[model samples]
Target: MFKYFFVVFCLSLFIRQGLALWCYECVSTQPGCGTQFNWLFHWTKICPETDDVCVKIIEQRSDETIITRSCLSSLRAIRTDIPADHYEGCRPAAKDVHLANYVNNSIKELDIYRNYYDKTTWCFCFLDNWCNSSPSSNAHVYLIIGTSLISLVYMF
Candidate 1:
């Protein structure tokens, strides 16, 4: 029983460490992504720094805007630089399929990359502070409260 518990504990710790590393990597990647991509949903109204070809396809789209400004903005501000052939390589949806579906799928995949990194940045800091601080939980609560206030202020 002891051996099994020890093994499980060790595995959990290892997994946590791996997750922490992944979180750090994600945070690091965000800034570049933010600069390169734009939302297909708001493509007509906004010019994302993405490839001109993709922009054209997005703008000419007659159906739903799957890529929102939020997604594009996130990509442009956080992800890596867009590739030269990005647009040329993007496959158009079949006539039978909804355009929105394709856009949504693309945006969703991009979002997975962004979220893995972005949320990690926020959570990692919170966890680090939680672990490093001594004595009462007051400091952790204070940090959380302060960050919440700051976020609220930015939102409004």
Candidate 2:
């Protein structure tokens, strides 16, 4: 009986690890950051298993504007911020760039855009598949249900 319980516990742990989070990846100055645009260049990337948040930044300057999207650690997700001007010789603190915990599960996305004239926007997404341009239908949910059913059968 003890051995059976141990096996079940180990299986649960394995299933939890297998259902890791992933976020959409893209960076562009044009309108379509996640989608395709005619003149914009976009790259495809997948966040590491350790990352739990997706981040997007849009900044405008005198000469040019930029937009970026990437994955961030859960810890850095709460405290993420971008300096007004890094190219203009403003050095930000080390902690400003690191990832942090997300504040709330219900709050899927956070938008921080202070300047209307420059139109700089910073967005962070904490929910699963929030950043994906096209997400598949409830795949993770099915995996969880399947695992639970298998576990129940084994126990019986």
Candidate 3:
């Protein structure tokens, strides 16, 4: 019985340490810093509600813009100071001079809304240490069977 208890304890500890989840609000916040950051496995018990998740940023600018313009090269690093009132021209952080030229020159087909950050368009990730709250990762039914086999080994 002691041995069985030890196994259960170890399993519990392992499950606790197994995976971690992170969420980021890329457009609305600073780089790699925000309330959206979450440990997917643990947060459910603590908050039990909406928790923001991480993202992978992607750029659709022309090849020339990516190479020539420092700002366009790293989409993830764009500062979040874009003005709410401005819509006609480049939004500073979201702007690439080369991209503008590409569109003007007919080299790029312009889809203005596509450039902006939208939840439907943004990339998603299933991070390590994260699982949906419904069926906890600890719900592995085979764990007991594995424990029983290990205990049998000790009996021999």
Candidate 4:
């Protein structure tokens, strides 16, 4: 019975991990966008399983800076760097399925920046959760370990 419970618990964890690709979602017109202090009020957005990348964009204009974040299709996420003011792509936490094709078809037309608006600076990032922080993992792991230990203690 304990063994069965353990197997079920582990399987549930794997299932949860497989079912979701969470990302940060926010848009701010403030000057310092996505900085540590600015994220205090923002929340993480649970993205669809089909979306593999979390993208963050920072645009600096003469008057004000804007920050936006969302989950994107792997195709769109790949073209983070275009001839813009500023752009960067971070390594995805999970293996991207479209990476091979993107690398092979490195054409200028395929870039996402072609549609971008003019700006002083732009930046992008691909990460697991919000800004490289996986808030759920630590809690989930602790819960699993705590449950296992309790079960063992009760059994003994």
* Tens-digit per-residue lDDT, 1-156, candidate 3: 888677677767657644534222223133322223322323322112233233333333443111111111133344332223222222233343344333444435545334533212123334322222122343443565586678767755
Greater-TM-score candidate between 1 and 4: 4
> Please, what is the TM-score per model?
0.17, 0.35, 0.23, 0.42
Q: Write the per-residue lDDT of candidate 4 for residues 1-156, one digit (tens) a residue.
A: 867687668667658865576665666654323444244455566666563556655555465555566665432545443333222353223322444453555576763333333442333444334543323333544675687777666656
Worst-scoring 10-residue span by lDDT in model 4: 83-92
lDDT order of candidates, top first: 4, 2, 3, 1
Clashes of each: 20, 8, 6, 1
Candidate 1 achieves a global lDDT of 0.29
Off-target runs (Cα >4 Å) in candidate 2 are: 1-18, 29-44, 49-51, 62-64, 74-119, 130-156
Query: How far out, in Å, is residue 42 in model 1?
Result: 6.6
**Ranking 1 against 2 by TM-score, winner:** 2
Question: Model 4, stretches more than 4 Å misplaced?
Answer: 1-14, 30-34, 37-40, 49-51, 73-127, 132-156
Q: CA lDDT of each candidate?
A: 0.29, 0.49, 0.35, 0.50
Per-residue lDDT of 43 in model 2: 41
Q: How good is model 4 by TM-score?
A: 0.42
